[model samples]
Target: MSGIELKQLSEKVFYLPGTVNAAIVLNEEREAILLDTGSDKDHGRRLKKACDNLGVKPVVIVNTHSHADHYGGNDYLTRNFDLPVYAPPLEAGIIQNPVLEPIYLFSGAKPLPELMSKWLLAKPSRVDHILEPGALELFGVALEIIDSSGHAHRHYSVKIADVLVAADAVFGINILQKYPLPFGQDIGGQIASAERMADVGAQVILPGHGEASEDIAGLVKANIAVFEKAAKTIVGACTGVAATTVLKRSCEILGITIKDLPRYYLNHCTVMAYLSYLRESGHVELALQDNELRWSAAGN
Candidate 1:
């Protein structure tokens, strides 16, 4: 949390940049509404300090999703302040039972101890509110909750004061360059969400992992391009190939090396997302042969 500064985007909105970008929106009553907490307890403390320095109190925390990097500080924040935590539908369950993140990532099997790091699992915190996609008024601030699912199940973006807190609906351009195939559970939904972001009509777009930008159109296009390219690579690799084979070959095409369980599973899930997207779009189909399931281009 060293060297981090609270930057004010608007009179009502402030942000702290760290591993993840968290925003603070001041309501009419002078209380603060935290957009998302950062990656751990220390982040929560730092956020608290920032609020104190700004002369505001945080009365509520609205998590954009259940990913540990976005909500890991919830435990500390909730325990320290009398704040209500709000999370999206399916994500709320995972936030309150952090172990579920690793469990589901491991396909519902017991995850390896190494897979349960703080990056993937955070301490559990109670969810005081379950948010749905719609208009919400909290602490005198009006917010439009947009459905931005796919990066994570039931993920959401928040719109207020001309800034869109776009959770994981899209990644920063640098993050896209680093992980060519971004983690997504449903590629179709992810693409749709990116398109939705383009139509958000906000003056500024703040992604979960990147600096805020006013070029919402450019950002949306970049995000869609990444998804489209990954889909193409996966589809091209699917010439009667097993899912695992497609995953491996796609990683090779993207120059991504999976050296650890976390990286391996994340990329594996991403490839699965592409496969699902291809199948749903009628570009690919699945078949079983020799006791193994394989994917092939549709009508092949």
Candidate 2:
């Protein structure tokens, strides 16, 4: 980095490595406050290099969520810097234990090498300060922290100026391929979070992965509708069919073969977890009959 670090958005916001992004705020004497480390220790090293070049100390370090890919470098950051790492209180368990970031076991997306890479990168660390979903006051920035807790209750998306760091609140379906910019979420909390963003009326949106966009409120709302409709359909099917049948139907509807998807049944695990969440929330009900899991919307 040059003597002056580059800002990605209007001002005071910069892109960190991987799926990570951060906001820089100037404190009383004018020091920078950093937010969110990327997927690995390399990102922390890069941030330190940028700090060394900039001749300033970052007064704060905050995580946007507890996802491994989002805050895996916290160990490196905490060890090297004297700043406090703030995260949502609900995320403290997983951030502290790391085993709670369990998506890795099912993603089926990352191969063993990639998994090992993530495992090596994911060293546990403690949160020095707790954060809730609310506006935060720092040196020079008034951060509007919204409880965008659908992707994870452990998540918060920050808003500054006209930009909202959407952070998986809305994303493209095949985000990793870097194409298909549809919102990839179909869950209750995710729907509500997108609606919140729509209501906020930000001109620009930044997703957890992939590119940023200008004016996506309508799309976010549309994706929310998709979630509701899909949820209803899933719950309905559960009433009459086995889990495997539902999974097969879902695969057909989504236009992919099980063999072609991530080997670990990531696609299946996602639905299973979503169903589990819905069942626990009283939105859906399930029973094991004939040696197969069956489901239905409550009272249906």
Candidate 3:
């Protein structure tokens, strides 16, 4: 397949691969269900074209999570087709009110200009359905919604036939290598989700941001390793260090550079996630002293 072209995943399922992979599932009537729209309207346009080229009419959209990139193309697709959108509960709130993304990222304050970019805030789109985990039937296709939260609150992955649209529960190996400290709101949950994928029993697994693979165990292990390594780095840095300093030191040790406000805030959020997870796991502790919140190794 060429750029943004469709690749077959199964008899009824196909995918358009780009920076973010969008899955296309077809019903007997040739109506399509889009698993995710890409980063913006252009991606939406391209996805629509790709489906058109396949001779399928997109009838529904399911956002695997609330992250902008996962649902950014929602507005364009919905506007053009008036399709019903489905997403998990908590994620649905953010997808409709995208400002919540930047708000929460800035610690519930008004976000700065840089934080308000499309990378963090996509245009608002309507969600017609709130998907719950377990068996679901969409346009005659049977699917199982698996709970894959942690990367984003209440995130989900879809399983159609023997193909599992794993979403971000487990990223592709290339993505894992590119981003040493993968983004997660709950490191422990992220690790658990990756582990869960090992037994999901899918013949083919499609990660939201990487190549699809048949090696479920290998993908699971690679993803879990990244989270565990990040946790270890954060715990090692937590020697009476403030959250910001911990993020800096951990990134430094990981050979990552926070080049801009967006990346800084993103890495900062992930670092805080690791700290929260480590503290709960009893590897680290949080304290308030001199009007500053700091962290250190447990029992320090």
Candidate 4:
């Protein structure tokens, strides 16, 4: 952990920053509760070393969701220490059976080989506890779990003191710029969660990725804008077009290129979520003609 030092966020909170930010919160007894491990075992080992440097033992892990990058390090940490893993009810199932990620991404069919990479599949780890949205007490530290599902079904965000581990509920400004549409399994829920984060009352917010900031309101606004922009683009693309055609047109308009199956399917699933949201909102309609499903603006 030469360059990977645990940066302090508060009197009791520290985090190791990487592709995903893994937080370390110290209880009264100095036991650490990790919030979301990084993308793989190397991240887990580095986080452990960082903990050793800080003179604290990681006694528990709280995963915000089932995404591979967020929970990928759970197997390493669980194997090295007797840490109890806590995750939202639905997400825990996928955390234990990670293949479900690519399976669902491929529209419930057997995923192609390209979809089996570590970006989408992580080693299975045991989930010893299930988390619900509410107050939680662990290792003598008080935590508030907020239901922020939509990015992944049943994703939860954690609040410790004035610091909120927002998870993927709201992406950092850089993340928003990196992936215009981001990723959402439920676009409606995603938009609602982004709106809710503004009222969460946390002075400082730590995203699962990117830098922490005090501008919670600004972050929430940016996230909602991205969701709405994607929704508008998808809606415009649905002019009696097939799903693939809609995805292509939307990506082209947004300057997004899908050169691999992983990127393609991630965007495809997200676009499908947008369509579902628009259709449910009565902004769009779908029809089956000649065995080809077509989408168009409602009443058109």
* Between candidates 1 and 4, the lDDT winner: 4
Q: Model 4 residue 85 lDDT?
A: 99
Among residues 3 or more apart in sequence or in different chains, the pairs in candidate 4 whose N, CA or C atoms overlap within 3 Å are: none
Candidate 3 off by > 4 Å:
1-4
lDDT of model 2, residue 274: 62
| Candidate 2 lDDT, 125-228, residue by residue in tens | 78887887778886667888888877666578888768787776766333533321122223567777878887776787777765676757655755565566
7-36 in candidate 4: lDDT tens per residue? Answer: 778889888988899899999886899999
Candidate 3, residues 217-275, lDDT tens digits: the string is 88898898888888888889999979999998999999898789888899999998888
Predictions: Cα RMSD each: 1.8, 4.7, 1.3, 1.4
Candidate 2 residue 121 C-alpha distance from true site, Å: 7.7
The CA lDDT of each predicted structure is 0.89, 0.64, 0.91, 0.91
Backbone clashes counted, model 4: 0
Candidate 2, overall lDDT? 0.64
Residue 87 error, candidate 2, Å = 0.9
| RMSD (CA, angstroms), candidate 4 | 1.4
Candidate 2: the clashing residue pairs are 238-295, 239-295
Worst 10 residues of 3 by lDDT: 1-10
